[model samples]
Target: MTVGSTPPKTLYQALFNKRMLICICTGFSSGLPLYLLIQFIPAWLRSFDVDLSTIGLINLVLFPYTWKFIWSPLVDRFVPPFLGRRRGWMLITQLGLLLAIASLALYDPTTNLTKIIWTVAIIAFLSATQDIVIDAARREILPDDELGAGNGFYAQAYRIASFVPGSLGLILVGFYPWSVAHLSIAAFMLVGIVTTLLMSESSKPSEVPHTLKSAVIDPFKEFFDRDGWQSAVWILLFIIFYKLGDSMATALETPFFLDMGFSTVEVGTVAKISKTIGATVGTILGGVVMIKLGINKSLWIFGVFQIVSILGYVALSIVGYNYLMLAVASGFEYFGVGLGSVALIAFMAKSTSRLFTATQFALLSSLAAVPRTFISAGTGYIIEAVGYTQFFLICFACAIPGMLMLFKIAPWNSQKTAVEETIAE
Candidate 1:
């Protein structure tokens, strides 16, 4: 099979498989709590007349995401006391997230800012932990041939989960008290709990590291050993910079819309319709195209859309207060993001060795999140200093380094593995 050739599988055969269904569950289970923290909480705080600087500093509470790799070895080292390795941790974290999210409503963000910060931090921690197990499970269960399509479905499911909080939760806030809205959002974690109970565990005791030292040290050693240290470094840098610009640009998106003089109803309605539909279509299209385009070409094609999407933000900043412009810009942004995410996720899945699936995926994903967690903390100051228009232009420029790295990491004509080469026929 050539890199540009399509596989012989029918569309029905591609979409209707056991592994793909698992990908959907993984995506939904992993995305919900994250959307709550990143989307719902910021809007909730901003609605209470919180200053932009304080709201920006509140992002610091999400630092757990960037450091999740530190504790991932423990997950790899020890199985849960109850369920098997992956399922056990999935159940534990899902339950913890439910309790944490429900409890968030008890403290008023206005009067209990400190409590809110601490509580939300715990939610972020649990959410990050859940992501590690889910990502590992997805990697283990999916066949190599299904990586691109499976990850595309996974990204789509993740985006769909966001509609629950980003759309429904936001709408509820306008009518009900914030507490009611929060509990409503928390109830949705039931989906993840049900999924955990129903799905089979992916990891067996023999497959993972038996000792803590082996769990902690072997994944790192194996990664650096597979290729020369130089190539490994380039791969790590590519992961870090690829999503950096996009993450920072959208870090304060909900707040940015509100600041642009859009009403909550307007933002919520627009996001519900535009982002949901656009991202869904883009994700499916990205996945299907990836079957023929291969990950390398998909990255190049999607990178163009990703760069163009940043300009949508720049357009929104210029147009100011027009809902029509808001809809167009946000819709394009979501579509581009969804396509780019499919490619990046497939690449990550391809990169990991099965023996170190949990640890290595966690490490890579955690590095990818650094811009969102740490660098994004300063976004409020940047917007305050340079204003929205200039901030977006700066983000567009920042995206170039990652695209440049693609020349070395995933060249346009490169067929990375025999699996990809065969699948392309």
Candidate 2:
């Protein structure tokens, strides 16, 4: 079957539907364990005085999170008994996430690095698999008219994970010692457990490709048909570095705050509360604006704001210990990230073919995390040699290569044609 478009759903329906709410909740679930496996884990380890490179190396456990597209097909094509396809996979993977994270709480990163890494690797893998199912369901279940709104709702939930897990986890680590923080991290995974058990999958997708080859071959064929290797290159580059500067700056946040004479309590309180508040507001605002202004226009606007948010870090470096600067910069950056990220995600969600939803979304979304991976990988070395000021400047420069290459990678021309075609269809 070919791609088809339906008229947009009403505002009321988009906001209130049971399936839509479930889709949004599960989207949050998909990201919950990821913080433990990637973001918060490093900070926790760092608290124990674990070497920075070790923290960076532990990040490799998350390769699965960034590469799960290779195996999303198995989940899409297979099913479990009692529960339907997506639901069953979601249930099983959520259980795995719960177990892995709980076990992580039990291991001592200093004394048991190997065991800790193994458990985290398992959790990251399961989390990525859950992403495959949940992302496909969110994209497919919504009517064509509602993809943007649905994406908005889903964005709200997903960024909540981004905020709550990382920022709050830091606070948890600050308030308690390492052992207690691990347990708190485990308890946080319960959010996913509750969400998966409570939420039902959407109706079996009418457009889901029925056979192996269609699901296997059609998505790639259609993707290339729409935009060639150059478009793919642009998207891939953006995914890998759109936020490289910000992310590089982000990786050193806890250290920088500590160096600047802020107490753990201060960093935890400001980063946690500010990020949660900003991202929540930013997500809802982004979604609403996407609907009103239209997705295509919103992308450019949101993207510029994303780039600008890096200035917040630059702001922090320039004005140290000023709470006002801290608050504005923290809030604005988190908000911009939340708003911009949803636009990027919704755009990716729209591009997937039914047969290849999981694979394509996995590829694009995985690419989304590539920036974090690159930043996390070398954050240790950067922080060690260069002070925060110079490091942030270097990080800021990484944006240039990607932004300059945007035309070659995802040219405005293709985005324009794609929008026009959608409107015509």
Candidate 3:
């Protein structure tokens, strides 16, 4: 099937298949711990008198999410026994995360931030690596028109992960003793490891190239040598700037909520119900919009919406923490995110040459969080520098690059012809 057109395959064929189900389950399992360490953990630490500046600086541990592309080529080119291409690497990384999370549970951050940071970093790194592998598997397996719907499912699972750990866990932490909360989260990690082990590998191990020269060396040369590098560069910038607005708002959410005197239950209520519902509704809406409008125009609409929603955070800083106000703004931002994300993923999928699908997709998708990860690492510092309102505004401003780059790529996004790709410079 062509990248732009609907695939002839049926949705039932993809859904009933065991492989896709495993991909969905494993993807969600691997996804759960992310916000636990990045957003929630930092906020928890602050209650112990952890400095905001320190929290901001310590977020550098998340650098792996941004840099995972460096090793994506390794995953694309190598495979282990028992599992093939994507699945083998998936198991390895997921197992590694299980160990990392357990290690963090054993080390109390109040007592030892040093050890906790290292363990969190380890989990984040492995998780990012696992995402690259799983994404490659989905792109290879799913039908074209179904890609939008598949992304919807992926977001659903990811939002659940975010919800369970962030919302449910937070609710427990507020009511129960620390021991209970830590033990509960650790138990969840154990279940995740078992689920990963029991699932079948998505793709079978096949011989690609035996040597470093063939596997790692040749793909890079061809990707750059063929002059595909220019489009890839533009893509990187778009990804880097796409989520700046929402991210800036999000970076301060926990603190903002706390400052406003909302209990953990209130935050959890949003996570489990409102935020989760918004994400789900937004994803469905995004998939339909993409299908109706097509990738190019949807890119414009969604990208613009993404930036505009940053204004909601500014409103929150002004209006204070009313539940209704929070719900409406969160809905706008997260929903916008869900929509824009579908467009970006589909667009990136269209950009790949089929032969290099695994490597190229990894590179593109990992860049998805570059802006979020980059700005967020310094989130505390930025919060300190300009304070919350200005930070949101700055993030809103950062989104301009998405349009600028998209316009430059308009030719490429519009027509994927050799003639278009090779215009005289």
Candidate 4:
């Protein structure tokens, strides 16, 4: 086949590719620490008879994720004596996560609520740090064309890692002591630790920032310089708004399900399982289509599904209490969002300059998280004002602005130009 008309790899070759294996490792390692913080820690607290409000308040510990960009520059600047810059920080953060997670088991949340908060907060910080490095590594290692497929595998493996803390770890609670369960979870960090030792550092030593100030200042400076003021602003705004509506729509999900008269078990079991399956399928399909259609077109297509999926929640809100309907709605939402996320991540990866990969990627990814971190707080009030059906309808409307912005930031025909530029480089 001609270079431009090369046939796609067979499924076996695609799945067994070396870089794909590294992507899986990166996803699992990056996911485990965060899941331990969100899923396992909350379950651990509830098991100790902690009140719902206290548990909710404790979730504020996840604030580090929103602010991780501040420290991410340091990740771009320094390297440890041994491993290269990316792997060095990855090793440290992964080790810290391992210790911080296990340390949680040492505290009893009922009696040591303050202590538990401190420990889990450390876990969050370490987890966020790990994310910065892992993301940079993924960006650096994958070629321009592979970003979508690489991130698709990353997303799928991330979901699988969630099962460790969300499902298996919780199941272990029934059969084992909390300490043992926490220790077992800690042991899983070894998956990352070993992966770090085995895999070659994705970034080169020469790419390390020459000075710390440049690390902080130049990532921002270079972004604006390359894209210019107007385009840079558009990119930032697009990142913030692209996922906003879906983020808002799902913020009050558990409560919404409960209010619709579905039991917690249905939400916990059926919704979660079906969503996982749908997400896996959607991510894989998105990766394949992205390879064929390229990032710009994939963004337009995946984005439409994202907006359409919000209406599923509206349908579920009206249908009420049907387990089958819940599964269908939740599943489609997950699938659609998964597709959008793969394209979005690939776009962000492509946008970054390799020298500032960690800091720029962190800033962009952090901006994408704003709606989830801040706007989600107001979702309950919005739902209170206009019941579930109308709230989701509002979300469907909110998604439009981002889709419109795609023409400005990632125009449909731009993908071909982007590929041509990559070829020139």
* TM-score per candidate, chains pooled: 0.93, 0.87, 0.88, 0.84
lDDT of 1 by residue, 312-383 (tens): 889999999988888888888888878888888778777777778889889888888887888888888899
Question: How far is 383's C-alpha from truth in model 2 (Å)?
Answer: 1.9
For candidate 4, lDDT tens digit of each residue in 1-425? 78789687676765567888889988999888776765567567755756444555565667778789999988788788878888888899999988988887788776888988888788888888899999988887887656666777888898778677765676676667888888888989998998899889888767777898888998889887774677678778999899888877765565566578754455557776777787888888888788789878898999999999988899999999898999999889988888888888877877777677788888888888777656665665677677889999999999999999987767787754242344245
Model 3 sits at a Cα RMSD from the real structure of 3.9
Ranking by lDDT: 1, 4, 2, 3
Off by over 4 Å in 4: 1-15, 37-60, 106-113, 170-184, 252-268, 318-320, 380-391, 413-425
Off by over 4 Å in 3: 1-11, 14-19, 143-146, 189-195, 411-425
Task: Tell me the RMSD of model 1 versus the true structure.
Answer: 4.0
Question: lDDT score, residue 236, model 1?
Answer: 80
**In candidate 2, how many Å is residue 67 off?**
0.8
lDDT of 1: 0.84
Model 4, C-alpha of 185: deviation from truth (Å): 3.6
Alpha-carbon runs more than 4 Å astray in model 1: 1-14, 417-425
Question: Which candidate number maximizes lDDT?
Answer: 1
What overall lDDT, based on C-alpha atoms, would model 4 receive against the true structure? 0.79
Ordered by TM-score, highest first, the candidates read 1, 3, 2, 4
User: What does candidate 2's lDDT look like per residue over 270-355, in tens digits?
Assistant: 76577668878878888878766665666667767767777787778778887777777778777877777777776676656655
Query: Which pairs clash inside model 4?
Result: none
